[model samples]
Target: MNTLRLAALEALLLTDPLQKVDAVNALHLELPVGAEQSIQDPGGIPGRPSHLEFVLPQKVPRRSVHTLQGRAALVHSLAHIEFNAINLALDIIWRYPNLSDRFYGGWLTVAKEEALHFSLLQAHLSTLGFNYGDFPCHDGLWEMAERTKDNLLARLALVPRTLEARGLDACPVVREKFAQAGDQQAAQILDVILRDEVGHVALGNYWYRRLCREQERCDFDTYQQLAKQHRAPRLRGPFNRPARLEAGFTERELQALEEQA
Candidate 1:
């Protein structure tokens, strides 16, 4: 039987970006969840395009949003993030088997939404005369995925709750930049992403707490320990309090984030 997890694995291994997006969008959600199966690591986990160049985060030159090329770069950067997001969602679905079936289903939905975000950004990029690979990007998201590969709890705590949560804080500022640059279309695309990402991060919070409960660990404390253990980036502020609240972050979490600021 072509199970849900295996199908997600197939999509994850697709190298061509558009094809991967299409495959994820077309994923069969009705298939059996196959929650108890332990799938082997097939390597080549996240197949990315060959032409895309990855530079260190600092090496990627900053561009102004005022120029057409600069706006294109901005759109391309968001597209790249969405692309990595699709893989991250799929990775969560297939990599950690034996969880509740809802866990896989929730992430599969996220994978499709990530695909939609990518397609939206890609279309906008085309209007700006650029493609995803036309701009240089960093691999920070997938790097965190690699680091959290072995532990499902760590993956939940870090990727969605930690890394993906950062998107919640950043989306408003980035969207405002697009709007200020008169790229309202790009700003609208960001709006869609932000709306969907709130739910994605909420899923992370839900599952992270579920695991912490199963292990009898305090959710906030465990998250703090995992962040330090994984060497996760320190979160800076102007944090999105409303979005974080909607995404299931507790009051204490918000206070800690504020204190971190």
Candidate 2:
């Protein structure tokens, strides 16, 4: 099989509702690139298993319910998100060529952590009598990736710091729900994800700062403008202040973010 182009790999990463196991296994394959005619054909890759089709969500719809099934479904959906996250991190390393070795190393670390998160969530989903693909999921995460593809600085700023940092803020609430439901296993899984995500976002922040330094610009103000220009969601609080601090967000930056909210 021919090695897929960056855009093709990115398309694969965005395919939503993928079975976690299938998606993980597909990482081992040499992805094929389609021709221009094939690309515009909309027929998708032939002879390749359609076990996963990553598509972006137009909007993030709010879901609310108070039932075990509903909770389990939500957990499965999050698991699917994490599965895509793993692929996204790996694809960054593979698809974006010619970066410093450290860049690849950083993304590799993220890939490993995302995989760990996926495994934890998938195991918990199994305990709930549902698997990773058993529930519908939004594709908002991958959408940001697509939007920032041409700008590495924007990709680092929006994806890890903005989008994934939202995960940091929301994780505590999700953990509380799992705890209330007496699903300590799921709660524990979320704990691991939260911890690792902080580091991932920190890596993003580090790179964003590096890029800013290279361009001789103000990181904080530039991030704010990019966030606005890209229509990035405004962050709300109660913030995970301690985690954000540990994740390389300065007090001034946090204050600026809070002011924006």
Candidate 3:
């Protein structure tokens, strides 16, 4: 039977950006979760479009949002993040088996929402006279995914708790950039992304704590240990404190993050 996790794996392997988005949106969430299924690594895990120019993070040029092409490039960069987010969500669901059914469903839901975010950004980019692949991008998000692929705990800790959490801080800033650039539509899209991303990160925090309990570890200490072992990026501020709190970060975690800044 074609299970939900299996379906997500298929979607992850789709090379075309629009096709992958459509596949995720069309997924049968009502299907079996296949929690115990141990699907083989089919290679080409995250199929990429041929035209995408993957450049080093530092090599990707930053453009002023005030210019038309620059705004489009910024929008393209966001769309790329959403696209990778969809893949990250799908990868977690399929790669980790025997987890709680909620885990798979949670990530699948995230994948669908990420697809929506990508679609919104992609459509907005068109109005700016560009498409998703119109600009160079970095694979930093997926690089972290790769580093944590062998460990589900690390994946949750670094990818969602760490990487995606950074998005919470950046979204409002990016939204304002678009608003100041007179792109009200893009700004509105960011609002939607921010609202949904808070829940997604909360979900990660929930599961991370659950796993910590099962592993007989303190969540905070384990997070610090994992962060150091994984060499996760340092947290910076000004953080979106309210959003972080809404997303399930405790007061102490907020303090720790602030201390890190």
Candidate 4:
């Protein structure tokens, strides 16, 4: 299926939601790497679903899940995350073709899982009289993606290990909120996300350490250096230690996170 990176670029070039995901689904990473040195960085926002109006994170309102619109709002936010996640995966695949082969294939797996999460959330949103792009969202995630576009290791340190790992710590709290609101289905969906996210975060940890080793840098210290160098967001806690451990964070790393976040 063409060059794998180009297939990712095709996914990133299609603005429609389903079309973009279909392009991702069509990817075959085993194909020979084509003239990757010639990939042109696309302009405007990377292929995104139409009608997704993005606002600053502070501008997006928070709502409780006690009411129908409230529940839909919360779920819409998650769906938006998954959608951007698809773009992030695609962006990394094409933007850094110079990385190890496993890097590209690993991100393909992430893109597929993100598509599943988005599809699941889209279906759930429908039952609540909502669909994706039905509410305003934020660009914090992609902002970081754009910031780290030129640095693959920084992308690994911040996007996946830092931001995505934050999701692991948040899942239980969000699930409990859904459960309390009597939306068992939404709560169950968070469980599904939690399961898959562990692997995704694990991938980040694996790559982060591998890259550090390859560069002869200390893992924990290098993460700190990158976080400082890139202005990665400060972590906060009530950290889900078990989930973090399962996702491959070392105890010292966890302590560093706690100290700084």
Superior by lDDT: candidate 3 or candidate 4? 3
> What range of 10 consecutive residues in model 3 has the weakest lDDT sum?
99-108
Off by over 4 Å in 2: 1-66
- lDDT tens digits by residue: candidate 2, 1-261: 343333334434444433433444454223333222122213322112245444445433335535768777778768867876776675565455556657656766676678678777777777778776555566677678778766888888898888888888889999998888777888888888898999998999988999899999999889988888788987888788889999999999889878867
**Model 2 reaches what TM-score against the true structure?**
0.79
Predicted structure with the largest lDDT when compared to the true one: 3
lDDT rank, highest first?
3, 1, 4, 2
Kindly give the stretch of ten consecutive residues in candidate 4 with the minimal lDDT sum: 29-38
For each of the candidates, give the backbone clash count.
0, 5, 0, 1
lDDT for each residue of candidate 1 in 1-261, tens digit (9 for 90 to 100): 788998999999998988999899788768897888889989887889989999999999888989998888888999999999999999988888788778888999999999999999999899888888998999999999999999999999999998899999999999999999998898899999999999999999999999999999999999989999999998999899999999999999999888976
Q: Where in model 4 is the C-alpha error above 4 Å?
A: 33-37
User: What is the per-residue lDDT of model 4 for residues 3-28, given as tens digits with 9 covering 90 to 100?
Assistant: 88887888877888777777777787
lDDT of each: 0.92, 0.70, 0.93, 0.87
Per-residue lDDT tens digits for candidate 3, residues 1-261, read 799889989999999998998899988668898889889989997877889999998999998999998899889999999999999999998899898877887888899899999999999999878888889999999999999999999999999999999999999999999999988999999999999999999999999999999999999999999999989989889999999999999999999999999
Q: Give the clashing residue pairs of candidate 3, or none.
A: none
Clashes of 4: 1
